[model samples]
Target: MLKVQEIRELIKLVDQSNIEEFVYEHEGSKVEMKKKAGIAVPVAVSPSVQPVVQEVVHMEQKPVQTAALQTETKQEPAAAEAEQIDTSNLHQVVSPMVGTFYQSPSPETDAYVKQGSKVTKDSILCIVEAMKLFNEIEAEVEGEIVEILVKDGQLVEYGQPLFLVKPE
Candidate 1:
């Protein structure tokens, strides 16, 4: 199991290195860490990688079948639309942590935003649930969501691209 100091050091490393990914094993469980792919991923508290904390983030599941279907169908039109935009200067939105990322608040709800959606810094684009906490991930720049790189609830690695945003 990781110690408190270890966790803190890990967080420091993530920030200092601009590295987007990290992980740890504790008691019979393994937790992965990642910064938001495009923007830094948010942790509830400044992530310090505290050892033996009550929280652990697991990111090892496949996307729900339904969510995959939704991505496939919805992404086609979005991709078509995105193709029309110039992408040479697009910025990316990355995963913050190793957890289940939900495009919407819940499965039955519409997504918080979609491709072509205009967003600015602080605009929440999605939720990454870690250790039962739903952390809202916000956009850090003004841009258009040109592409979504990860499907809802898919296991995302640290620094994995969640969305590709084309800055205006």
Candidate 2:
């Protein structure tokens, strides 16, 4: 609910103050901050995605403490990157919204893309049904489908990874 600058300012203020814990909730949005080792860090929660944590480290040499703001996301992208096999530079296509995952255009139709299938930039990988609408999910990169992250009819959350592709 707050702007990035406002959030940054809040983190800075919390870092500088003696307040051990700070919690702010407004209109279903919440922010939690804690004082850790004389530095203030924020722990953010989102209903659809993973938790995002930002760490602020203040140094006395800096007057504005702008340099203290650094994001250390709890859902580490590095760890995800490490999990991918190094043989190919795999790219993950994630669900853009909360929906039911579907492998084919329809039950009788063949799957748009399957494991080991080559896909071009415009290839339709699958469909995601959200609010009774079927949204065609297209491949943004040319690749081979190494893995399918969700099964047909599976409910997927926003940002949930759906496919792993080895780029051609």
Candidate 3:
């Protein structure tokens, strides 16, 4: 059986990862974890104890509530329209993994790249911190950065576009 602290550590690992589901079994003990809408919930089962289920039922109902609220307020479409950008001709610099996006190396340093900055294929653009490791993201294509898609210190997903660049 896993200790309470171990289980908590596992939960924290799962929550920080890109994994959708994880399962572990040892000597007839089973622990399963699933992530829904970026929320990680763990379920543990053992032969001697009843299965424990923790479900986020409210998260499942949020879409329905949001739809009703959108119709009632009639504001979502306008907000969406205002946030739209033309990306058809831009080259996207995408995050290679799920992590916290940092615009600069540190708090006092300037960002590696900014809008209107010229970059080569090997130019470092930003850093994505995952599991306490800072992975420097590069501009994989030679271009001029047209826009920064995400703000500093934002949580980003794998393959999420980070910048729009006009290829040189």
Candidate 4:
């Protein structure tokens, strides 16, 4: 059985970040959550507890709510801060082997990060599928993805510029 404490923790996690949805299901228990315009609605389904359903009531508070949420996110922590990237001279992270460079782990999934995505030194920029093996390509430097030089599922050559990053 899922407890109220667990639900509260989930709500706290949602409040602390830009994540829009949280869903978890295990052993006949399911919890689904959605946050629209800074209001979170959580629904939990478990065998032993009665269901709690809440209707989404959109009020005439869009501008105020969005601004408040934005302020809160900025004040909490700078998770999405754009690093000071020197774009005048862009650095290129080249592929080490000949393979198909995938922007994502799977075809049906979204890219690991989009252009203008800030990355740390150890962030995986993309994946290279070669000889039936999928090898992850890591960013050699901390920067923002200035340009994607290769398309998804495109065959990339050795030492090719899979992406161009502007270093911080």
Q: Give the per-residue lDDT of model 2 (tens digit) for 73-130.
A: 3445555764665635688999987667999988999999888999998999999876
State the lDDT of candidate 4 residue by residue for 48-166, as single tens digits. Answer: 43232221212222444676689566642222332344445888899988767899988788899898999988999899876567899998899888877667988676787777788
Model 4 worst lDDT window (10 residues): 52-61
* Residue range with the least summed lDDT across 10 consecutive positions in model 1: 54-63
> Candidate 1 at residue 103, lDDT?
95
lDDT tens per residue, model 1, 79-108: 687578566788878888766689999999
* Model 3 ranges with Cα > 4 A deviation: 1-39, 43-85
The number of the candidate with the highest lDDT is 3
- TM-score of each model, in listed order: 0.50, 0.50, 0.60, 0.48
lDDT pick, better of 2 and 3: 3
Q: What is the lDDT of candidate 1?
A: 0.66
Q: How good is model 3 by TM-score?
A: 0.60
- RMSD (Å) per prediction: 11.3, 12.8, 7.1, 14.2
In candidate 4 the C-alpha lDDT for residue 83 amounts to: 33
Candidate 3 local lDDT, 1-168, one digit each (tens): 555534544555676678989897867778787886675565555653222222232233344345558857775654465358677888998999877899999999999988899999999999998766899999989989988878899877779889889998
On TM-score, the candidate that comes out on top is 3
